[model samples]
Target: MPYPLLHAKAALDELKLAARSAPGIMVGVTIATTALANVPGMGDAKANWNSLAKALEVEYPNLIGNAVFLSRAGWIADDREAFLNAASVFSGDLQKLSGLCYTMEGQVDQVRDAYALYWMEIGLLAATVLGYLLACQAMKLTPHLRAAGEILLARLTLLTNAMIAQKTKVLYGFLAVAGGTLATSSQSLGQLFNIQPTESAAINFERAVIPTDPPSVYLAPKRELPARPKQQQR
Candidate 1:
């Protein structure tokens, strides 16, 4: 019912609140998006998700983030915007950086590690793009269409969370590899000038997870995809 962006902003605001208090905790929040929030006879999926989130928030303390409609819509819109603006640039950067890192890796172990790291990075990025596109298609559904796009969006939310978790792992690998590369480059530069290389800062960050409720919680009962418009006989 709400503009996808507004829903997305609310979700981010919630996460920011959680982050401020429990800076160390990484929450896997989930949210459901449905136009049928107030519809009767059909399932009241949104309310159920809110209740679940509240329960989890209380039970898990800082471990569980609230996964409600706002957050789910917010994530989808935000990711779509990101892909629109920087997906191409980011993809290029990853390719270039991965190639550079691979060249720098000398030992067999280093080569293997770099290969695995880059492979996963590229794979995850591709997955992220595909997920975003799916979300886009789902969000475009109108009342004229019987199928609920929110249901598809709900499923994509789970996939997106998984991609985020994988990205975190790849990010940690990048920091380590980049740090070593910088250190190696620094040492080479320092040796030429008879100066010592500075120590690189250790990079450590917890992976963020944003999980959501199941599709049934977001989809309406008796929902069917909208049929194609039939041509009138002339």
Candidate 2:
């Protein structure tokens, strides 16, 4: 019923997420955009931002407009108008939210690929270095192809497993953080909708803030302050 608060809360959520992921996202986008921009005459680095915005607009073009219309039509509460200023409650914000999520996932995948690739490359580089070292140590100066190959394979497997474990830990940590956020947001939403915690939580909140006198004080026989004696009539 209170549309402004509802929309404000949603917008606030996007803002918080944006703030949280901003640093990593900036790194990812910088790397990604730089990588993408190097392709000669691609001419659409910004296209991603536009495409995402348009996609969101397609989904919710009337979001801000309708919220405005609702306010004018006396459908929403007065206090809630504060949320729909000139800039907010629009598809752009949602798209930003979507883009942030998309870019984050993209970055994670890129990093994963890079991690695997780097480890694989490290194994190759190490093998090459070790191979050269061995060749130098040899009297015949010919590398042992089979022995080097075996060592490389064994090292590669071990490195891959270690990387996998690290990635697994990261993925699980992401899940835990994501899950906890969702749970908190859901709890907030339930508070909004009166779906969870029943009446007791609110009552408890009130009691905590303005606590009742102890039961004994209320229950004990009260010693009333002596009534002011009536002034004698002149």
Candidate 3:
């Protein structure tokens, strides 16, 4: 398998793992929100939980689906090195995205009571910390998703352009071969019948120039005709 494909597969695997683990993260978030609601004046934490849940349930999955589609589309990497480089970056971004769910779960698990007289203060502080972490992760997530998209687009463009160039070369090669065969056959038939073969601009253009070679080398040689006989007295 090509390196680009390998990296793409790794990225897709990470995305799948993240998607599979999201429901578990959601459960942890729900528990954390429940605990926070039991304390007085933790509305902000609950709001944050709602936002995070929406991301996990809706936005994250949508992004993953897009990534999967792009990755599959970009599987035929004409520029292997460039594609591999882009795929590696995307793979790293995907790993970070997948790790977010685990990180969030860990943070949620740490919402225990401090059991001090300032327990309310401690709970609020914990909520603040968790909220801050969640916010940071959210910020990072958006950019990583955007980067993944850009990388895929760039590689796809490269692949597309390369394919077009290759196909054009092949088409030109086929035309050159067909034109030569036709010209040779026509000349042979013209000779057998003792007739002059006609030439056309299109056939001349097809036979004379090869796009891949230097024009000077492929141009037909100019032949000097025998000196015309001096005009006889009429």
Candidate 4:
């Protein structure tokens, strides 16, 4: 029988759905960090935070002229990155992205009713952007580690999908391979327990053993502690 167009495409439908939903997991974090990026003289975290209370002061001005805007139009879109990008511009706090205190402020908010919230969003976004950039840079620069991460991620995806399908035999096979490889690597650092061409498990069972060695850190420090009496008077 010929496959229908929809049937051929259904395999990735769940993955696409999951990807769409996963973006929300980080949305709150982005929004929160963006708000914190906008406060002025924001260094010395303690001082910045103290001033932030005053900065956050949103008073009723009907149509105030000195207000700050964190999310645009009194609110932000659900897309965290876009919201953060806007907040950074609104506060003029890119330096905050470098872990430095932002000393700039914008007077674009006409309501004065939202300065506090705007200030907060800018601060939060600055921190988050810095963190994201650092993480992305590290991941990009480290290829071996990145490969290891990808392998682990692939295994997780496999496990999740397999578990849902109840194909436990495949899961068990994967576990066996993983466990055996790890066991082999751990048990044999040199030539002893490694599998050899003429070796049989029945004949090699006795050779599997770990060596005993004094850990380097446990060596005497060359300084002595005074001895305590074995028993104290009751």
Which one wins on TM-score?
Answer: 2
Taking the tens digit of each residue's C-alpha lDDT, what string does model 3 give over 1-234? 544334333433432333242322232222222222232222334345446645655676567667655766544345555665765665555455444533433333222111111233323433443443344345446866656554543443344334334433544455466556546644643454464346642355455765555456554556898999999999
Per residue, candidate 4 scores C-alpha lDDT tens digits across 129-148 of: 33444454455468867765
Q: How badly does each model clash, as a count of residue pairs?
A: 9, 0, 0, 22
Q: After superposition, how far is residue 147 of candidate 3 from its true place, in Å?
A: 1.0
Off by over 4 Å in 2: 1-143, 195-234
Which has the higher lDDT value, candidate number 2 or candidate number 4?
2
lDDT of 1 by residue, 1-234 (tens): 433334434444443343343332123232212111222211233334345444433443332223232244545665756644564454444444443333333322343344344334434444454545445464555664325564554455455446545555564666577668758754653454564444564333365456666665564456688999999989
**Candidate 3 lDDT for residue 225:** 88
Give the lDDT ranking, best first: 1, 2, 3, 4
Score each candidate by Cα lDDT. Answer: 0.43, 0.43, 0.42, 0.38
What's the lDDT of the predicted structure labeled candidate 4? 0.38
Pairs in steric clash, model 1 = 8-74, 28-209, 30-67, 30-211, 30-212, 31-67, 31-68, 146-226, 147-225
Model 2, span 137-226: residue lDDT tens = 352334556566545445543443354345445645665665575566446434544544656464465546754466564445458898
